[model samples]
Target chain A: MAKVSKEELLHIANLADLNIKEDEIDNYLKNLQDILNFANIVNNANTDGLGETIGENDQCNVFRKDEVKEFKDNELLLANAKEQERNMFKIPKVIQ
Target chain B: MDITNLTVHELQEKLAKQELTSEEIVQAYVNRINAKEKDVKAFVTTLCDEALKEAKEIDEKRKNGEKLSSLAGIPIGIKDNMCTKGVKTTCSSRMLENFVAPYNATVVEKLNEENLIDLGKLNMDEFAMGASTEYSYFKKTCNPWNLKTVPGGSSGGSAAAVAANLVPWALGSDTGGSIRQPSSFCGVVGLKPTYGLVSRYGLVAFASSLDQIGPITKDVRDSAMLLNIIAGHDERDTTSYNMQKKDYTKTLNGNVKGLKIGIPKEYFGEGINEEVKAKLEEAIETYKKLGAEVEEFSLDIAQYALATYYIIACAEASSNLGRFDGIRYGYRTENYTNLKELYKNSRSEGFGPEVKRRIILGTYVLSSGYYDAYYKKAQQVRTLVKKEFDKAFEKYDVLLTPTSPTVAFEMGTRSENPLEMYLADICTVSVNIAGLPGISIPCGVNGDNMPIGMQLIGNKFEEEKILNAAYTFEQEYKFREKYQPEFKG
Candidate 1:
């Protein structure tokens, strides 16, 4: 069975960019570990000759001719933005 | 006449004959929703005024002698995951609670083209994650069959809306049995087309590889008619299959003679309730009497499908949902001093517990050290599962299995156990894993009088075959009449 520590849970949560609460960590850890333990059964299967299936269809590299289609709806696109500046989404400063 | 009780085809004929105007039909459905919405909790938003206006427009066009499509004047309940311009398309999540889509989804565009009136946005699991609507950040949708039980989700409201007669038909998305399981629970017809058969453009992404929008309706013919409108190639969706568009309704001849059907032994094993099994047995007997050859088959690799599905689905979800980090168009944290805190707090506050759990698990599996062990291994196993289905289809034209292991459990019965909730998808997920078409039609009712559904799974792009087979059983059985809910309206 897979055992996940609180620190590991926090680290994974950090990687996922989620701010898990201190009280919720134990529950997340138990559930994540149980799911992982169940997922570990894949190791028992014989995959020596198998190829990974990223998608199900036979068609790949689908493309269309390069053509410009004007959206003409920037106001609508930015309608849901919490904060906007000059019709662009405004976010907190990232640079130090 | 109670117009809301009519199927899409029946309503279409009535509208075509000018016996009923689209305006009157819309009014009837609106009245039904007003009467039963409190009990069913099926809609996240109801477009009553807009639907009536659109219905009047259809009537106006008919007066001008304009051609009408099959879906003209039909009221469709769209699952909230699909984008609808000028409509609040909350994926039943707090993150998108206030988000109004700027554009319509591909299917929504097609429905609009066909002049189908949008009844409103139906409720679903938060971003299509859970097997029950209990995970919805919005109101819980109860089964119309029994208000005490869950309407199986993440398309629970879509199924419930149809079953409760709030809408004649609805659109739903299935990643891993999201459409089929709920349709089973609600005693309706739902189809999850082959992965690329229908375009996924504008669907709020949960697992891109597995998600496909499908039709949920009162009967098989309606399922086919809706599929006819939605199934096709799209330039926006890269994964959309480049195949000839099929008239799915044309294939429903109610003929299943000499068809080879396989009953997977693995699906009938442990965890299935006895009553559900009995119902499945009776369905098999019906198939046998329809001149279809039935035999027991084994899909040994299906045991690993659920585990692989979670790993792959969650991993893709972790990546796909990364776009919702409070910057672009979703929920933003109110108080954040820095950018890092902004992303963390917004995501943390925006997502529910189940979404957080899946994101964390996905992050772990796709992380550096575990990539090969979990994510890569799961992909290889997915290939194996697909190969098994391909081999089975070589001999059998279609496969039959129970849509869900059991009937709808009580609202809170399995909510606390996430593993138990995931196991409820055992009978249906492999079809998605293999990229096959599957339809769930109500076959019988269990001891509690809840509906039991039998799933018809077809090989890739074989929706025609499955629809015909389901139509045969639907004609022979008329299962809906046996289990119709007594709506008080």
Candidate 2:
């Protein structure tokens, strides 16, 4: 069973966009390696040529009539917002 | 007037007979929710006031002698993962903690049209990831029979509430064995409709391809009734089937005589606990006595199901959950210098360990170099698994196995060993792999007095046959008749 090196773990975490605390890195690396090693058993199976299906129901291109739909009151919708502006949600500005 | 205890079919029957008003039925269930839910921790929120208001309108319509649908006034637990137009549909996760859906799921809309009372949201595995309700960010759902053990999850709360008679039935989504395993542990009927049978528009995606919303109830009758309400085509859900739904209740009485029931040798293997095996063997004998021909069968691809399922489910989950980053809105971090840091920090803090583990594994599989060996290969194996089932079904009308290898273990027992815990799903994963319709019916009590369930699998779109065999076994076995949940106030 190959273990994920500390450097590999850090690299994968970076790709996942996660920054593991330095103290947490070692254990996360070991645990993740265990899971990966465990998953290698799946490699044992031979999947030759089956097309990938994202979901069941062979149907595609279902169309709904486009129409206005009433939903919750806007007052209730933004009631819990941390910040609000002009009856819309406000968040940390991206370009700041 | 405790109609919450009444099966939906019976409640519908009573409403049709004018013996109970819709308001009265809804109020009955609402009252039960008020009194009992505090103990079971089944619901994330109780919508009794809202439900009663709707119930009153339903009553007014019926008083004017309007046409009443079968689902009208029947209270049903909607798993938190399904979106409700104005209700909080949180997926029992902190990520969606403050998120209330703006649109209803396709099934929820169908139930609304059918006049089913929303019993608010039942808790679930955060993002439908775990096999135990323990993973929910909300309060843990307790098994009604024994509070110490888990209710079996990510549909744990759905099964627990139903078993406690807090509500007669509820809707649940099955990915892997979420519905069936929990049903077995909670001692209720849980059906995973043939994929695409019921629409998944509102179900929060775990593994989109593997997810199917279905009914978890005290009996198969309610499963059929709920199926009737939720099964149909919806433009919003492209995967929803356009196939004909022949009132599933009608199929309940279909004769199982001469039906070929396949018994897989792999399912009854050395790994199965002795107690679960005894009950399953008894169930087979009972089916034989009921005039169904039992035949031995093999699914050559069975051994590979879990591995394929994990790779496929995790890969999809990794992508589906990508929508939850701290951007358009789910959980956003209190502090982050930039978008990248925000996404990373918020998700790392938000998702539980099991979920993070899966996302990482899935991410790796779908990553550039490993896609063929992991993701693509798993897809191919999934095909082989499906092909194997197609062959088996050609020789048999239905397949039977123990729903789970053992009864519910201690809540935290397998929490440490993810591999050991995943093994618990061994018998049930194949049905999901084949995208076949399957139902878990109570067989009898294990000597320890825990519930045991027997699974019945049928060919895709052949739910009628599975229901036929299950109904026959249910009727003849009479185990469920004596299977009372030992709940105390």
* TM-score winner: 1
Question: Model 2, residue B353: what's the lDDT?
Answer: 74
**Regions of candidate 1 where Cα sits further than 4 Å from its true position:** B487-489
Interface RMSD for all numbered candidates = 0.9, 2.6
Model 2 lDDT per residue over B1-489, tens place: 456667777887898888988788777777777777777799987788888898888888878878878667777888999988778888888888978776788888888888888877998888988787888898888887777788888899999999887777899999998999999998899999988888888789999888999999878877887888788776666776777667888878847778898998888887899999998998888878778899987665555888788888888988888877765456777888776787888888877777877787788788887888778877777777887888897899999999998898777887766667777778877788778899998899876568898899999988888877877777776665676767532
Q: Estimated TM-score per prediction?
A: 0.99, 0.93
Task: Write down the DockQ of candidate 1.
Answer: 0.83
Docking class of 2: acceptable
| Full-model lDDT, candidate 1 | 0.91
What is the Å distance of residue B163 in model 1 from its true position? 0.2
TM of chain B, each: 0.99, 0.97
Q: Is the docking of candidate 1 incorrect, acceptable, medium or high quality?
A: high
Residue A27 Cα positional deviation in candidate 2, in Å, after optimal superposition: 4.0
Please tell me which predicted candidate would have the highest DockQ against the true structure. Answer: 1
